[model samples]
Target chain A: MTEEPFRWLEAIANRRDYVQQQIGTGSPVFAVSLEAGILLLGVGSGQSKVFEIFDRQAMAALGHPADIERVRQMLIDAAHLEAFTRASADVNVRRLVSFGLSPQLKQSFEQIFQAPFMIDLLLGEVAEHPSKDVLVKVNFDGGFKIQHGGVMVAAPKPEQVTLATDWLKANLDQKLKPESAALVLLLAWNSLTSGTPLPEKSEQPVKLPDALVEQLSDKVVEAAVLERKGSNVARYVPLMPLLTG
Target chain B: MNTGIAGDFLGLLAQNNLRPLAAESSTRAPEQTHATTVFAFRFRDGVLVAGDRRATAGNVIVADDVNKIIEIDRHSLLAIAGVPAMAFEMARVMQVSFAYYRRSQLQPLSQEAKVRALARLLRENLPLTLQGVGVVAPVFATVEAQGDKVVPRIYFYDPLGAQFEAVAFAASGSGSGTVRSVLSFQERFGEVKPSTMTLNQAIRFAHNVLTVASEFDAATGGVDPLRTVWPVIKVLDANGVRDVEAAEHLDARKEGV
Candidate 1:
């Protein structure tokens, strides 16, 4: 086999290895960012959640902890839409119902969040009271939380809408659950076909200092590049429970 | 009973010269930096947690695909938007703390308890906040209790140990100002209820919101909707987390959206 091809395969292995390591460590969080173009990680604990940042040796110029600290903070902190999932092993049927959620919902949430997973809730719900403040109205007693969103979707109409009608009719129902699903599909589809083109920048531009980049593998860099370019990306990833398992 | 935080768990870690990297109350970080954004909003029937995909340092876009949200426990969501390392470290500490408690108590921490746990984490990060590299504030939301159906909920926190619930919407981020403006105005235009509009409509609404946010919020960057690369949306209904398919979003979008 060609050395280049072998190296490419190795790159793929490296990406999987990174993900596997994160999974094995029981972090219980996996994130796929359209902008980041890769699976990002956040570690979950009962008290709080922690994110992971890799410092490249190149960033030695910026000073040790400071440079890495800045990058780590930025890596997990940046995003427009983020999802959080929390769950417990214990099931409290009573607590579940009080929040307007079905026992099933509670169970599902518990099963999901209870284990380990983090998703960006691009969309969800909220309730606020003058005195009570804004609270998550959905009562998830022994379950999970999953949140997500898309980057940019188009409002295709008339010609494009009609043109795409055939595609819709053909691929409509390998799935169901309605409304939300439809929107995701269209927006994703539209973005893939005719999304905004990215502006050209420094290929030799302000490279993120070599040292800082080193903490991450080639895969991380590749993913970041795609995310930066604004490509319409999608994947039906299992929550952390399945990922970790 | 003892969720992660200033309790014995942290105390024990302290004995070993360890500390939380994420909470707002940990010791002061040597330097102050990193920005995290936690996005949450009300959906037709429940609440959502959507975050930006970018993080900044001074003026640079330091990281993309940063996972700001953390699963504090099952059915609950937590996110931080502060000093990167400590915020995340504390988040991990608290996660392990929660698990320890869950194992010890043989039950998960209560939503209220989880809040308390985070408060403790913040309390510890106090020194750091004072120093400059503070984990400072984090946004936490979980399904506390729904009235009849699977209702969504949201919450925000302050350094002073305040957890404020938000109605309509709440946000934190670099381009938050611009994105918030778009969300506020768009929300004002009208609502597409989960019951009224199909799930597809909900996804479209989400996409529409994201598009608007991206236009204004530089942190959120992506291409317009296209084939294949649909945003994978999840719906929290009577049944936990349901993956909102792309076709449905499109169908809803076409249906008068």
Candidate 2:
């Protein structure tokens, strides 16, 4: 009977390995708080990877299509209900992660009888200024951190995520316009996906390959921004035109 | 629980059995606060929606600064002429619902869906409407894109939730009888049709219609010239809702400026 507990633990470990393997091949999604707004960049294979969750909040996820869509719908339902029952301004990232999504994800992950979610997501909320922008990275196990500013990355492996964020911390310019920011994101993506080591912090940032830059016009790029100076209450805008222009 | 993109805010609320209110006893109704005098008309630029700033309770004037014209979204305006509490709540729900639909579905709700959403809310409020305490007759105005061009569309609803499309204009509340008469007569015999009037002329015509209503109905506050408070007027065009400047809509100048 005592061996049963150990078997449960072993099962949990096996589940983690299985989920990680399923997600290992997915691309990384990036979010950077810029002077223009919070820029979210994600590349998808015909499916959308970036979504606007509310007026001031957006998300980018790399996971199974069904899992990503489920989380998207769940967040949308909760956000609209909160704005309806309370006020729009009351809907913030902290409450959503702390009181809503984190708990739901934790429960799903820990429950022995249910399948776990295979998703890693980055949620970005724009504020009146860049310093106060709320950027969060949520893992499949429901763990997250509130990145007040700077940049965030969601990748299949924790080591890849660490390398990319460390590299971004040294090189990213927060004031880049949408087009320039997208190029920076592509460079980080290239290093992560190609398994190439990024240059040292003191070294110049690397340029994206010519073939990859040419492939951007094919529309695989899904990008959006939460505008800081927007007049409308809903500030999320698709940035495809800005990037291509 | 998974409503997906086809889900609606109100439907989600209903699935959770979260109706706005529980039906209390309809008997022994009290004197509830009511708003009065709201109208809309098609103009050359687009549509003009206006409302008097008045709320009354029983035979007494309760407030003079109650704005009845509510902006539902960028492309729509809702003007209520009945119970202020109920109407305002309905307007708030509509505003949030429209935004929720667009965000979740990644597209704006169709115009037909928008109108039907309002009708559903009014029908749900039928219990209160029958109690003589929550009757609301409202006018809704929007601009529809027909091909490359946009046209103004106005609709009015009865207390029972029946909606009718207005050919040229719509009016509601205790003062509606007067507003309808003047607008109808002017449309046929005035110097210009209401549809042909420019934005400047439409501003004057809106003030005249509400002013005439105030003279006939005690509930309508009309234009408060003493306080230099003009009616709340908004213009809806292809670009969306824009507030008419006081200088454009109000004829009188401030004391010395």
The candidate that achieves the highest DockQ relative to the unseen native structure:
2
TM-score of chain B of 1: 0.72
User: How many clashing residue pairs appear in each of the predictions shown?
Assistant: 146, 0
Look at candidate 2 and tell me the lDDT of residue A42.
93
User: What's the lDDT for residue A87 in model 2?
Assistant: 85
Which ten contiguous residues of candidate 1 chain B have the minimum total lDDT?
A: B1-10
Question: Per-residue lDDT tens digits of candidate 1, residues A119-213?
Answer: 11111111121121111111112132322321111111223323333333333332222222223232223222344222232122123324323
Q: How high is the DockQ of candidate 1?
A: 0.01
> What is the lDDT, from 0 to 100, of the residue B182 in candidate 1?
59
lDDT, model 2, position B8: 81
Instruction: Flag regions of model 1 displaced more than 4 Å.
Output: A1-245, B1-17, B22-36, B146-151, B186-199, B222-238, B241-257
The residue pairs that clash in candidate 2, if any, are none
- DockQ per model, Cα: 0.01, 0.60
Highest lDDT model number = 2
Quote the chain B TM-score of every prediction.
0.72, 0.93
Per-residue lDDT tens digits for candidate 2, residues B19-53, read 76446866887789989989999888899999998
